[model samples]
Target: MSVPSKPWDSELVAKWLEGRIEAAARDQATADRRGYGAEDDYDKAAAEEWVCRSLRTTARESEQAAFALRIKQLLDQEDYRITGIHDDRRVERHVRATLRKIAKMTKANEGFENKLRYQ
Candidate 1:
């Protein structure tokens, strides 16, 4: 079951990226103040890369979280029979797996989506 995403909001992404970039700047400043020398530049680069990766992961997780909440709202409004699933644990597992799959697909499709012109 593919969950189609709403169109990407450039403003929302820009806001989120702004925060991440500011945090990275702060991190670099802290490292410099701690006497990071030439040899540590590599480590600094690696740390910055990690921060960027973390930001991307966080954005993906947040999207998944929003999707899951919407699903829950629908289930509640429609009065789905959770008991019919036999085990609540199984249903919970399935929900988690579905969210993970959605996150993965979002990341995988990001590059292709970037190439398209919306307007």
Candidate 2:
């Protein structure tokens, strides 16, 4: 779409670009609107990270952060970032569940080590 031309000296061009992007959002249903499956893997990871940082009111805030960090790290290793997903609550739940699984695995390993030491 053609942006209205301002005087050559006016930096209104940047503002025009921003407006176009906003209009695109208004015209379409973003991923979060349709749920987690709609978003790409990278976006999902980033959303999970944001959820950990932003969803402070959820239970076990520290665990959420850990999960977020883990997910973001994994995604980053694969070159990913959050986008297109607008729901923070769902992100928090996913991150929490992932963290719980990781925690269980770690605990199991530690228990095994302790038992080996006793033997």
Candidate 3:
């Protein structure tokens, strides 16, 4: 039940989010140049689609970070409760199982999941 490592790095994710937001803004400018029924209107539609996708990506990353922080908080509380326990591996396994159960019980996006890896 151990949480697997996430392929996406938080710092890298943050950078990409920032880049996407900037791109979305820039695209908005391109999209604004055309009026209704004008030629090159497709650019505006495409730009809007990109903006929506970028916003969704941002939301996903934020949610993943919040979930990770929640897991860390749960782990910290568990550690505090199990002071002086000598069985480190067993303790970790139990903690992992508990965290997994809690995570699964929580609501999340239907088709998306993020792993919580210990640093």
Once fitted onto the true fold, the runs of candidate 3 whose alpha carbons sit more than 4 angstroms away are 1-8, 37-119
lDDT of 1 at 104: 53
Model 2, span 10-109: residue lDDT tens: 1232232233334334323454465556654334454434433432222233343353354445434432234544455554455555445434433332
RMSD in angstroms, candidate 1? 16.7
RMSD of 2: 21.6
| Candidate structures ordered by lDDT, highest first | 3, 1, 2
Best by lDDT: 3
Candidate 1 residue spans exceeding 4 A from truth? 1-3, 37-119
> Which is better, 2 or 3, measured by TM-score?
3
**Cα error of candidate 3 at position 18, Å:** 0.6
Q: Rate the local accuracy (lDDT) of all candidates.
A: 0.41, 0.37, 0.42
Candidate 1 on 1-119: residue-level lDDT in tens? Answer: 35445654434543443454455456545555666353243333333333333344445545544534443443344222332223344444444443344345444333323322210
Error of 2 at 4 (Å): 68
- In model 1, residue pairs whose N, Cα or C atoms come closer than 3 Å (at least 3 residues apart or on different chains), thus clashing, are none
RMSD of each: 16.7, 21.6, 19.3
Model 1 per-residue lDDT at 93: 46
